[model samples]
Target chain A: MSLALSLAPLAYVACPECDLLLNPVVPEPGDKAYCPRCGYLLQRPRKRSIERTLALSLTGLILIVPANLLPMVGIKIFGNSQDGNLWTGVSALFKEDMWAVAVLVLLSSVLLPLVNLGLAFLIGFHLFMHKANNQLARWMHWYEHLNEWAMLEVYALGIIVACVKLAGMAELRFGLGLFAFIGLLIVNAMLSNELDCYFFWQRIAQLTKK
Target chain B: MLKKPLKTAFMQGFIRCHDCGSLLKSDPKCLCPVCGHHVSARKPNSVQYTLALIISALCLYIPANIFPIMSVTQLGVAETHTIVGGIVALIQSDMVPIALLVLIASILVPLMKLLGLSLLLLCVHYRWQVNARLFTRLYRVIAFVGRWSMLDIFMISILVALVDLRGVAQVIAGPAATAFAGVVVLTMLAAKSFDPRLIWDHQLSYE
Candidate 1:
């Protein structure tokens, strides 16, 4: 309930890698702390962590609309032009009875990134305003776990692979959505990089505990 | 079995919550104060789950490569392509860079992950006295590259969606697409279930 209580507790840190208990290094903003025993990245406290995460997640949220809904690429084959949007890929898999891959694509490419961005935005927005939300801790927990599954960058590469494979068969045209999808990928990458777990957890623990 | 080290948190009555990274009293039944998630000293059945998943992926590895991933029909002619076949076609068509990309993502990465996790499992099972640090590095690499294997599955999905002009040209998912997706997911889970701490434990002298 005091001002100093907002700081992260540094009693000890167990490396997620080797579980070697050591005195936690309280890195300054923009500095990183690494595990002494197993070289796991212990912490990286970035400057303006909350604000930057909020901005990037907001940008990603906006881009998601155009990225997934609009046609990402158009193919011209023998005077026949067909456009492929993100949803069509999942639906196409389902049509071919590849439901497993369909769900995987849906979960990893579309749904998980949406969840990650939404959770991050919620967490970041509330934290920036210094507002108390009971769900902040839960949001942060899921955010960390689901971050790995949000594979926008990998899907971007998949888009590249798809274009490469089809280039000889058809004339490929880059659509506005492809650029927006790339923007979303870049924003998500930046947001993931900018996230400071130790700082956010400390802030949440401080906010909710009182 | 190696003697438990006194320096680590597990032996010193502190269990870090994997979810929120909070250091707490070492109790198997306690939920994390911040996240309300179970706190464990290590991933339960780490070696067994990793070994089982890796073996399962290896089994799927065969069908994933042999079965055609996609069948493309253009102008009343149909040709099926397995993963290797697709890469070879790409190479023959002077697309070596894309061929290499597919070769790496579809075949090499999964093979490396399966082998690396198996070696780590063997190391922990035998308590192999080797450089724990290097093995830990290997574990990190396996974990990082696990997601990229999905590159092929996503490509097929896009191809299936983009090339749907009936009779003129169409690409339909083959049986291998499902199995290939399985290999990627299982290997990722295998890597996740493994505890790198087990590697460092072998460095401790037997009591």
Candidate 2:
């Protein structure tokens, strides 16, 4: 526990879920503090969370290209073959004038995830390099709100469901993009676990205190 | 009381950053000194906003299920599949496990969302002195499972994108795709807008 954090009754923490007030405690490194009333995770002390999250976010960014552009799955029937990548789904929907659905798919599956990773990268980069400006807060705030809308893991499940449905109808082929996507999903999952938002907010406040 | 010395931070004159969870002294001009985002005692009109979104989602749920979600065209024949129709097709083909997954993800999850949110809204509206803690957990469950409803939409997109061997066998998204997506998105928004804290306020009042 840092001296700053140990002075707790001065800054009572409220549970976001259930409105329970608590005196802040310094959880052991990588341990969580949950609301006694509703079990909402108050915060956790992640060890070097910024560095790890930055690496995962960068990995996610690198995986995004192949995950979106390359075929995740292919099907063959009666001597004919067709393969689908993440982009093709949205484009195909657009071609059929299902533009609203296409746009939703594109945003949730592609653009929003990119925004999240990009913002995280930017914030982490600035923080690590000791370069904090007025814009860091805005970016961090945006990142918090936009994080929920990025559904890469859900999209990955959708891919698996799609493959299963097609299994009996034709010969199914797994593509490299599928592996890349799984990697991205793992990265995303770990990124969330490694993230300690309270820590980030404290760090940002310290840097941008000017 | 859920714990000893029961009180909320807001009651203690602390306004937490809604986005970052930083506690700031609650003032007339409440803003998180750390993140500079507005921090309210509670989300204003949370129940009303949640109710509105849930009502709209219930309305869209009809078209989402009524119309064909996608059509598989093969050998000059087109077979359109509604959500239920897809499950039946799968069952007839003896893919019980995948059939059950779709039935749950596409059908049951959305239904649960609509009904669950409505009940939670009712509880908050009435300020019923029911078990707030349980309902809070229910809210968490609903929020967690809500995203899985996108399973069918995604599957359709992939099918439409992948099975395009023209005149041999191709899949195309149908009219219901938009409605289904709307239902999922609206329910998610509703869940996001809801304040679970309200569920406990009444409990605290009774104490």
Candidate 3:
């Protein structure tokens, strides 16, 4: 045990799940290293992660404008038609004197996601340009923190549920923005799952060193 | 200290960076050289923060469940439904899968997360020597499944956006939507604040 501890720090990695210290072999491309005791994925570097994430991020960012600007749902009641988009939803909540709810909706549904996607694009762009400065590294760290709070997928699921419930009561017509929002959600999910921060950071480190 | 020593990175004066998987020499004041994230032996005040967050979530859970999550209006008639009421309404309408989804995502998951987190906190506090593995697994499950509770909140947002006929039919988000969102967010914070290392801390004590 003492001999193992005496080895170089780089030789060991602790399992985040079980806290079991194990020396893991660096897996070749397409392979993964898992926590021996608890099966938690320790490390798995994806091929072309940055490029793929950048493409997905750009797609998500493009969809956000349509998702918020264009009408998400069209409601026809008693031969009168009204189309509501994401921004109108916030205004409606405000009109009802639910300012707190309005703010929450605006933040979770719109602002947070926009900021996250924007940051992702900036980071991807900077890294692609080989501008590995401390500022970009700091932005990468901020991006990690922002990733958890940007709940676009959750919001998408909620929209689906709301659509289903509303279908029974009113003549619900799907709008173009709805599809764009769904596409945004899918692209964001793909971006998140594929982007490996470790590899990205490692690449940044190498570039900065150069 | 008669029992055999367990081989751990902590015991070896090293801590693993949570974000980058880099092993670094333990230094409370230092950041991980690889990822530039703050490295700590364990999350500072993890239990206290988690306990406080969980208590606040528990306080919010009542209102989240009791009040209507959202209201639907059609033809000059308005109907409000609480969390359970919403699920029951869906079930009544024969939308069993969606009903189950709402039930599990909004109601059951949050309640279970609170209970699970509280149990883990208790286990760590009392230094319970039984089933450490099970407790660790419970923590993992709570951490993972807690985020999905936001599904109901998301659904409410969508409903409010899509259903707007002015006079014929409209959907307005209720007070419960905010409270429910609070519960979900708080529980997620609670899970984040909790240090699973505390569970292992007791193992050394037992030795």
Candidate 4:
């Protein structure tokens, strides 16, 4: 039986060598399964994944600060320049009576990631201490819940598409916020990797001396 | 030619015992022309569950395509388009990669999932001989990826909410959001409805 079979309900397997979480694959009888990288038997993630996730998430949270504080996309149409970050766009949407869309964007891009980061922090902290905290499990559950809603990459895609559409009509300007946004994405990806549930669970086990 | 009346003939010959060529009455059950064994047959539920999911998926497919996904607005100009239109816009704007992605995620993938689930369901329902295990595994893979189609929808929603600068430029969402959401929800339901036991109908049940 594969390690995935043991831990599947909690988390998926990330190949230690490649860091790619392998999707389910059929195993042949007597086949010695190993990580796609380094040809070593792939088990669960390491204890440090939670720390890494927390560290990256904290960095992401910090980056998010500047990412929002700075202007995102700048429009210089007819020599009049105006730049808007996420909050501005959200406020604009609300003012225009597109309340539902405003709420969706706000929740998906901002609120959800924040909640995910918070959950990752708590989950990682508890696992590191090797304490069986019910709150940690609850937080982990909440993190999982938030992961799907925070579609930052999708939001980014929408930004690019909107930029393309606006090219002929407006003098579009990329601002510092765009760079920050890219940093947010990279940090978010890294955070997601670091906070993998498998690593947390393993760390918890080790702490418990189980 | 005259035909004679046929008479039913009773077995007059007797069975001979190996010891003495002695005759014995024949047994009622067919004990040994050679040998006898009882045969059993029953199908599994996973097959039926898988089939139900597929059918429901097909039911949602038509609505998913026929419905408009989003409406675009600029300078008092408004136009509605289906999933395909969005992809075309991306392509025309030299965002070919994103365009291909949108096409695959929003259009092709959902259709494939619907079709794949349907095939798996039908095979299980009919006890049709095929790779039951493979189908079961494929079902899981499809279910796992079913949510990713939301990428396009999420993008549209974000844009609609964010780009309302008024008089200069503004964007609004159309009726398509609900329809797209319906597609996602319905497909997910279909994937969930499929049962895995149908795969063993022929092999496990009969044994």
DockQ of each: 0.51, 0.64, 0.44, 0.07
List runs of model 4 lying over 4 Å from the truth.
A1-44, A78-84, A87-104, A202-210, B1-70, B73-75, B89-96, B123-129, B161-168, B185-207
**Overall lDDT per candidate, in order of appearance:** 0.87, 0.84, 0.78, 0.58
CAPRI quality of model 1: medium
What does the lDDT read for residue A108 in candidate 4?
72
Model 1, residue B35: C-alpha shift (Å): 1.2
Kindly report which residue pairs in candidate 3 clash with one another. Answer: A158-B154, A158-B155
Interface RMSD for candidates 1 onward, in order:
4.8, 2.5, 5.2, 25.1
Candidate 1 residue lDDT tens string, A1-210:
233244755787788888888886666766677776567888877878888999999999999999998899999999999898889999999987889989999999999999999999999999989898888988998898788787887888898888988888899998999999989988988999898888788888778787
Per-residue C-alpha lDDT of model 3 across residues B82-177, encoded as one tens digit per residue: 999999999999999999999999989999999999999998899888566667778889988876887887677666766666765778888988
By lDDT, the best candidate is 1
Tell me how candidate 4 scores on lDDT: 0.58
Tens-digit lDDT string for candidate 4 (B1-207): 112211101122222121111123333332211112111111124345555655665665566566666666665677676777777777877888777877877888788887788776667657787654466567767766776776665666545544555654556555555456556656765665554433443433211
Better of 1 and 2 by DockQ: 2
Quality of candidate 2's docking, in CAPRI categories? Answer: medium
**What does candidate 1 score in Cα RMSD to the true structure?**
3.4
Candidate 3 docking: what grade? Answer: acceptable
Worst 10 residues of 2 chain A by lDDT: A1-10
Q: Give the candidates in order of TM-score, highest first.
A: 1, 2, 3, 4
Error of 1 at A11 (Å): 1.5
TM-score of each: 0.95, 0.94, 0.89, 0.64
Please list the residue runs of candidate 2 whose C-alpha ends up more than 4 Å from where it truly belongs after superposition: A1-10, B1-4, B204-207
- Order of quality (DockQ): 2, 1, 3, 4
Q: lDDT score, residue B82, model 3? A: 93
